[model samples]
Target: MKHPYSPGRVLCALHFTLTVFLLVRGRPKFLWFRPLSPEKLMDAIAQLGVCFLKLAQVLATRADFFPLEYLDKLKTIHDQVSPMNAEEYEKVFARAFPDPSCFSFFDSAPLASASIGQVHEARLQSGERVAVKLRRQGVDRLVEKDIRLLRGILWLAQPLFSRLTRNSLEAVISEFSDMIRRETDMLSECENLEQFRKRFVKSDVTLPEAYRELTSSDALVMSFIDGVRIDDKEAIGAMGIDGEKLISKLVVFYMEQMLIAGFFHADPHPGNLLVQKGGRLALLDFGMVKRLSNATRIAMIEVVKAANERDFELYILACKRLGVVAADAPDDKMTEFAERIFDIFGDARLSASSMRDIAFTTLASMRDLPFKIPQEVVYVMRVSSLIEGLGTTFVDNFNGVKDVLPVLKSNLTRALGAEAGLFPTIGQELAGLPLTMRRAKTVFNDLAEQNLHVKLSRETLDLLEGRIRNMMRPICQGGLFILAAFLVVGMELPWKNEIAVLLFAVGALRIVIGLK
Candidate 1:
């Protein structure tokens, strides 16, 4: 189907093409085309509309794609933007509130504006103050078109990038597409907020109570938060809040979200977090939430435990299990990589630039390896980087390694799903000892009976299958050509020559595409 707005498609296509061109030119080999300045690049992205702006924010978390200078500039791209125009406000407001008597006092002006939607301050008829988040009218369609446009651009540009870069780009765009689409659905955001509210009841962190009765697909109503942005140092200090203590709380909360509960608010930027009276934290904007499966969460815990213990081999193994490192990745190189990472985390006084340099150096050393960031871990990396950035704002020597590891270590048992005492856990394991021994005996008996055989891992089998299929394609095309030649030379039918020619052309085209 055609885009709902045709002119928007044209504008997005032009700006996206320019943005890609500028980035390509930024490479050292592109001497003919001068790279645009970082400001110019940012302007191009901003002009691409709200979708690309959100994309730029995601890119800010990726240090491998851009240098520190570009990262510095991209970090300034905030979710806050110009509020909706009168036409957009009227359309969304009318759709959100068919009955005008829902709110006794509803402000037409938005309290805050973002890429997906804007929040308005309102008072319910029962005299309760609330904040209503309204999805921008027609934003879902716009986002759909923008995602399609980006995919088209990526398809056109894929040949220009190396395999690793191509895969990374695809993964980033795919993850961002899923996340942005989720953000456009206000009902889903309400559900996410309610889940978080239930989870945070006993914690120091606060979540706005979602009013399900007053919510719909177009809008959500929740209690208004009157708190200071976590990064506003001056205001926080004026309120007699300890900056270090506040950061500690934020880090601990994140640790609980990621490691203990396995459900986290992916966007931890300062603007999405607020500090209420008495140094309490209030998390906002639950549109971009993430959940970790049991296997992933367990592997992540192993990664942290291995890192804290300084076991390079264990760390690399955990990384492989976590799906970040290829299963067949060379142990020596991976060990070296783990060593460098541990060294960076070991130094409390390491500056962000120094850490970046070390990481880049390691990546350069292992450039040939098939390292990848899976979709499941994309937001994990993003949240870590953003939280580290926030911590560095208040403390000079702050890092996630230095701050979060201790918290995770302290909560290890709870994170492992063992809330009860340790002796009961030991007793439970002992109770299963006979069953474990029986399974071991079965494996031994199979070996003794000569029934044991080597089995390839699922990943290895898939890789082999793909390689075999690729190798056979051209062979099959050549066979088709041979059959066509035979038909032309031996067949006596009236249409034999015509069929032979058509078959020959089809075979040649297939072979040519495979070679390309």
Candidate 2:
């Protein structure tokens, strides 16, 4: 029998040659190949078009997924990107804005470029310094074409790539595409910038003020910040101040954003952060920001609190919350990891050097077991690691554990201490936590009862509605996935589109009904 869609003769020949060459170059036992050097890989990616560029982007934020060495390497290209053609920029600008004469402050050469697009430093009619970010010309078409090509390539390469083996390649590509698509749309970036602006409206944390009139789906104009990148040591010392103090404030500001405000600057590496007078940490690039769901928030706070207090049980659950360990992780593995955590903190109590080693060792071990680090922790850990790296480079004798110990101790005590109101509050939050078992119970209980039904109190309908909203989050998440799959399989077969769309409808119904 003949199978269609087989590799062509030339491709087969090339693949065989590459495989043989890799086998000679790499470990025979693992069958691991020596991948292309980073520079060659980056060059290959650029040649592959914007989709591969987007893939590189998703890889950039996934610091937790990679080992320390790989993470260190990724940092080098965190913002370094080859600029797009200048003539293409003119077309994008012209399409986005009818008249180039209107934005006379435009510069042809880009100040910086990235997977999403490039930024050009420009001035406004009001004589204010601003950065104009322009979307690449024909980006939407490119995205559509590249995504189609990417799906084909992923489908083709699934057998060879180890990372894509255990996980769903379709899911990974979907996440990557969704992220880049959102990035491509300047409207979304504006929304993100506005969302971030609202988070720090009156704080020391400064966000760019977006100029709506000068913005469109393809271009964005916003206030330009002038300050040294937080990573640059000489610049900070040149300003005549304590680098450690500035770094400390940065740690606190970002922590407050994630813990208190729930809107975090997801890409808070030193490059994305700038330092100015009075220890102001200017936050740039809101493209990768993440908002913690209330349940996730409470869960994260509990997890960190547990680590600070050495509560093994809470620690296990926290690992579960972060998706580092399965909810059903073997008790021995759980105990081992828990003990490891205690030892790490115990050493951390003695010195900062110990704390860093402990965290790295623990993370490395987790990699051997290899579980998915939840998206929130993935982003948080990257930001946290960047902070740690910046501290090492810019601050003197920096100890994150020591600096954060007081606040952490306070929070942990507040969470676990037997004080009157504190215990009750902790209990309430604990009870309210989103356990998978609870969701299963709700679903099956309704199914066992042989009909979907709801009981509502007339007097507290508003409160009842809000309570349901809290319960329906999982359903909403399911809806997004269903819609994505529907978009994929629609053209494949008859009724498939309808079926996929129906799945989406059911998901939405679940959410709306749950909220009710």
Candidate 3:
């Protein structure tokens, strides 16, 4: 089926390629993926370059599902992707920088390389030490193919899989795809870096100052940050630096990132974090940041309270309010899951027992639950692991989980007024009751006086435009199915008319609901 503009075709080709490669794959990587663990596969995919590598990195951020082996292995697939050669660097510099002829002192060699792009150690003609990041030439198209293939694979697997909802998986992938795509636009990333830096102005965490004059859509140049990578444990030890304090700073750093500033470095792995000799963790790569809205921030505030008070139910409720939980989950199922989580949460606070004991007990208790966790839990669980992983490694006998609760508790108490309740909000709304009644009476009076009235404003115009746009999306999609059908039954082409009609129906229903 040679459908014009079908991204699915690229996906089909990739599927075929992977299938053929795996057919000839080493006997080690077979039946239930034993040939290569999920982690090793990620490394191989990273080696393959393009989107697959990026995917492995994102999945590595998600430690909730994969075992510790995969997490440890995939974490090593660092930003060390192959760099573009000198010739390509020159061409890109010429394209991105104006007055390229005047350029006297830019390094042709990359300073660093990740799966998607490489950073070159460069000096401007102005004698500034800058880091130049260049997007790999063919990455965008590869990402497009990779994203399409993932969607196709998920769509095809919907009926066969029971562990996850297709919508849920697709939503997470779409978000990650959006983030990875943002990395392609170096200009946007530069702006993001500046924004994050600005947000963290007073904070100990900092980002490299992006050199706007040397920056462009394809290339980003920032003042070179000089520090040892956080993972350089040997160097850390040699300097006699406090690793536990650094991690403590990170915990507080990330807490402030989301809580106070409402801007967070979504990827805060050991690679992206650098520890200065004085102990400040220099945050790198602001390209994949997440900004929380006021509402989201409030939800997170509640999450802090819940995590501190050992309130799993409130945490679950907060998750639901934040739209982090799927709506289709059964109430009882979620409650039971919450109960099990509470057991873990309570156990996590136990000081008498070791982490391994708590973990073992938690694992044993999980056998009593029927509900599975959503993938987003990985991001949260990763935080827990970071606290524990870095904590145990540096601060012997230090329970990161136990330590975090006190900080969160003390902070929440100081920030949110120890006794603020729903009553205050209700009272505020009640204070506006007179105005609401006046408006209601006015509406009724207008109806009686003029038979009908609809006050119109620019706000109404904006609302109407939003409604129209939503309706148009589904209609435009339906048109494709209609066109496909016309070619099938009308033009006598061998086609899946049934599927086309179904798609049309789905689109029509969506449009109808949009209008409603």
Candidate 4:
């Protein structure tokens, strides 16, 4: 069946693609092309509306994917998105609460607005204060259309990317599509809130109570959360909360989410996190959440253990198991990558900015190698990066690697499903000893037979060859001029001078044309 394409979607997709294309062409290597300014790119994304704004929020967390200037602009996108107008707000409220008597009083103004919904402070008939989350009118349909448009664009460009790159791109789009679609459903968010409440019931971390009786598909009513925004350092200090303790507690809570529970709140921006009196943390907005499979979680544990132990081979193996590094990635190159990674984490004294610089540099180099970050790790990285950003706001010289590695190392036993008993852990390791030995033996045998294969896919080889050719062209041109000069000076033939001039002319022409 043929589907009708709207003009608006067509224009949006074209603008999105052109902006990205310009950004790529504006890289340092493309000297002839005019550079795309970060401000222009951010403006373009903002014009694309809420769906793209959400994407920009995720992209902002990726220091490796963009320059620092671009990251700075992207970080501001989510907070700056415009809220719904009065007419739209009234329409949604009416549809969500047809009875009109559910709330005794609802403020006309929203307390906060986001890409998917807006939150308003209201009071129930019993005089209890609540925050009502109202979904934007037709937002679900808008999300669906936007995702379809994005998916179509990606499908058209699939043949241009390598298999590994294609897989990673597809995984990202798929993850975002599923996440945003689910986010439009207020019921699912309510359930997520309830699940978190149950999980963290014993912890000092606070969660607002969900009013399931009052929630509907378009609106969710919950107990209002009151506190200072986590980033408001002055307010926190005035409230007599220890900044250091709050930072430590935040790290510990995230450690429980990522390393132990395997399920976590994906969005940890400052606005979503609050610090109540006595250093109690209140987490808000559960619309965006992520879960790690058992395999992925265990592989992450292995990655942490390998990094802490400085085991290069183990690190690469863990990366492979986590679906980040290709299984057939060359061993020597993987070792180099592992070394670069270890250097980033080795120094506890490195500040967040310095560590970020090292990490970004390493990742920029990795782009040329056979590496792909999986969908599962995308949000994990985002959460870590966002939390790291938060930590930097209050704590001096905060580094995520320094903070997380210790917590991960200490919780390895519990994360591995072993109780706080040495015997069970020993038994578990002994049970896997034979398999581990067999794998080691196989690797050694391959090395002995000189069968350590290096498989660079055709696309990667082509790209590398292209870069090499470009590099050698300039040298080859200079060599030609030298040869021509040598012939003119040394040879006595009548045509020698003519030949040298022709050679020089040809080389000069080639150089001139190459500049374009």
Candidate 5:
């Protein structure tokens, strides 16, 4: 095991601790030594190194938690890093390939550098051009150390912020750790690339083909793609590509990925997407991807369907089913949340800013509520946010609802057809309608007749019986008091006096018991 007292780790821990302390103090201007701002906090995280940088990237997705300015600063956090020198690359390369002659040409300089690793352009002996990605020296150890530090921080702070720590904070860190671990494992990336490449064969999206024999857990080799960055509108225009059409296709591609394919590239930032000559999109970086379960996909479809139909109740139901809201959440709170969400979508054209504002407002409203975000749904939201952000950048006056509704409707139609055929589904429901109506009618009639009965569990029955006894106790005590007074006034016998006394004592006892 590496020593726990590394200088780098100690500096990172101190930097994080101090930055958090300042933020908690909430008096950035009061610092005598230096000016502090949200931007400075972002810089602190960036300087802490790759693990912290990755954390900042995840934090940027949470518009609900952080301010827009902070998010803006963190959003600029990229994978760009100082490239490793030739000697370092050669040493790492030798671990993956025992002999150095497997490649005809290998560039000493890196094509791109990220926090965990760097990619270099290379050509195999067979003359195939490929991108060789190698993990940074000792990145695994660094990440493990950083994660330990972060976990310790979370453990220490959990008691102070119980509400935030109830689930989200720990969950976010755990998910990030899992994601980063997978990302560092190049074999996983190779698998993702191959899967996406196979999945998008019928679509216009291009994925670099992975060379399995040349790939290892520490290194990966894939077909190198040469294309302009998708975000470079001028370059795309120069190539005579229709910008609007390209954006539309991109949106459709993601919609299919989420709704139909049930798997999607979770990260689609401008840097990771490239455009080939025919406007074909070449997707890079498969380290972070999301796969939706069938139930979740259906629930998402239901939400879209409800939104299109302007049915808030159905939308809320869909949310509940999707685990977006608690299963036992109060109807009023869910309705309020759903209405707020609807208000955001009620407008005809929904821009990325409007969506983000809605997210912020919704989160603010739900801050005091028992709303919980499921782990699976977090990735879904991240992917949706990225797609919306990309759309906003690529297209002017982008209407997310307008662009997404048609694809949703199409997918729904296809799903319906595949499940039971649309007409048969309708027929099945129609066939069951009379029995349902009959049952409803019978229940209404029973209620009108005052003969409606509810089945209760033994526990519930005991509770109801206890409540009835309590209600009767008050009336019984009052009756006993009156009886005792009558016996004291109207009867002259010694026995009558004793009976009145006993009656008074019983009433007093009843009162005492009720109080208890």
Candidate 6:
């Protein structure tokens, strides 16, 4: 079906096309003209309205997909847009409520405005204070038109940027469009609030209660939360709140959300988080949230475990499992890529700035490597990076790696129960058991026949050591078992067989030690 064209759609297309052109041009050809900067690109996207602004916000989280300069500029794109006039707001509110007197008191001026909606402070007929969030009139039609125009542009440009298209650009846009459409539906935001409230019922974090009776697809009402902005450290201190402790609590809360609950607030920018009295955290804005599937969760845990252990090879493996890297990627290339990642993050304390640097460098280098983060996990990465950013603002010398481990460990224990204690190490060994046994059997048969004269070159030993260093705990355990079995089967003499028995005992001891 053919769609009608609008000025908003035309303007968005023109702006996006020009931005892409300028970005691709890189440098100015004319002597008098200066090259377009990242800031200019950000401004252009912001001008495209809420959808593009939200897109820029999502892009900002992808440290691994974009350059640091672009990321830095994109992160500053605020949701606060021009507010609708009182007359326009009244029309929108009337459409949703159909009763001007539904609220005893309604502010003519919006408390805050964003691309999709504007919020106002109001009092219910029952005298309760609430925030009324109303979608901008005709925003849905505009968004739909713009998205259709965007898809058409992408279709036309698919051949020019086949690589990007191959990377699932269309899929990403579709997901983003779906998300924004949901955002336009205030009911979805209310549901998000309820889910978060339920999830955090026992935690120190607080969420505004949704007024379902007053909510609809276009309008939402929730109990207003009174708190200081979380990033306003001076304000928090003036209120006698320990900013550092609150920051720590914030970190732990997010950790529990992501690692334990597998659900999290996707947009945790400073404005969305507020510090209430007694240093309690008040979370607001549930327009964007993400839920991680079990497989994705496991992949993230594996990546963290590998990074914590400094196992570059295992890190590569985890990335492969996460579909960030192709399964058939050359081992040497994967190793090199992993080495580069470790070099970036290995010694650096885990802070927002450091992570941004790592993501920028790693992604920049990926032009030559086979790497692509899955769309499903993009929000996860974004939320993680956001946490780091918030942490740096809240605490000095904040080490995310140090802080995240205990939370991860505790959540993993709860998730895995008693068996959770044996992880990648034992898991790896069991997975490789059959292959290890086969290799050991061949060695034992050769040795028993007196046909085996083992000789090791320094280079070969070095390679073996490298493999051992990169091996998972389970693989190491299996290697010991293999060695002990080979010794027992290969030895003919009583004394030598006794030594083999001792080796077997030692291997058993190693397994027990690993368990302990």
Relative to the true structure, candidate 2 reaches a TM of: 0.67
The better-scoring model by TM-score among 2 and 5 is: 5
Consecutive 10-residue window with the lowest summed lDDT within model 5 = 25-34
lDDT of 3 by residue, 153-221 (tens): 656555533333333455566766777788778888988998877777888765799888667788788
The Cα local distance difference test for each model comes to 0.79, 0.63, 0.62, 0.77, 0.73, 0.71
TM-score of each prediction:
0.81, 0.67, 0.68, 0.77, 0.73, 0.72
Encode model 6's per-residue lDDT on 1-516: one tens digit a residue. 113366664654555554553343333433343334686676667666766777777667655444567667777778888898778787898888887677999987888988889889999989899999999988888788778877877776666453422454565677678778878889999999999888879988888999998899889999998988888878988999887678767767876777667888888888889998888898988988878777777777787677667687888888777766655456677887777655545344665477556656566666556555567666776677677667667554344455544455555554433334567657867889999999999999999998887886322453464455444565478568759767677767667766777777777776667555
User: Higher lDDT: candidate 2 or 5?
Assistant: 5
Clashes of each: 0, 0, 9, 0, 0, 2
lDDT of 5: 0.73
Ranking of candidates on lDDT, top first: 1, 4, 5, 6, 2, 3
Best by TM-score: 1
lDDT of 4 by residue, 131-200 (tens): 9999988889888887888888778766656666667667777888888888999999999999998887
lDDT of 5 by residue, 126-155 (tens): 999999899887788888878888888777
Candidate with maximal lDDT? 1
| Runs with alpha carbons beyond 4 Å of true place in candidate 2 | 1-34, 37-54, 57-69, 149-165, 168-172, 341-370, 375-377, 395-516
Off by over 4 Å in 1: 1-26, 29-36, 361-366, 424-516
Instruction: Write candidate 1's Cα lDDT for 1-516 as tens digits.
Output: 245357765655655554544453345433344444678767766766778888787777766556666778888888777888999899888888889697999998998888789999999999999999988878898899888888887887777675555666787789889998998998899999989988777899878998898888889999998899998999999999998889888877887788888899999898889999999999998899999887788888899888778788998888877777666678898898767766786687777668667777765565566666767788888898898888877877577677767766777777776767888878888999999999989889989999976787434653565576676779798678857767786878788877787777777777777767
Compare candidates 1 and 2 on TM-score and give the better one: 1
Better of 4 and 5 by TM-score: 4
Give the clashing pairs for model 1. Answer: none
Candidate 3, lDDT over the whole model: 0.62
Q: How big is the RMSD of model 5?
A: 11.8
Ranking by TM-score: 1, 4, 5, 6, 3, 2
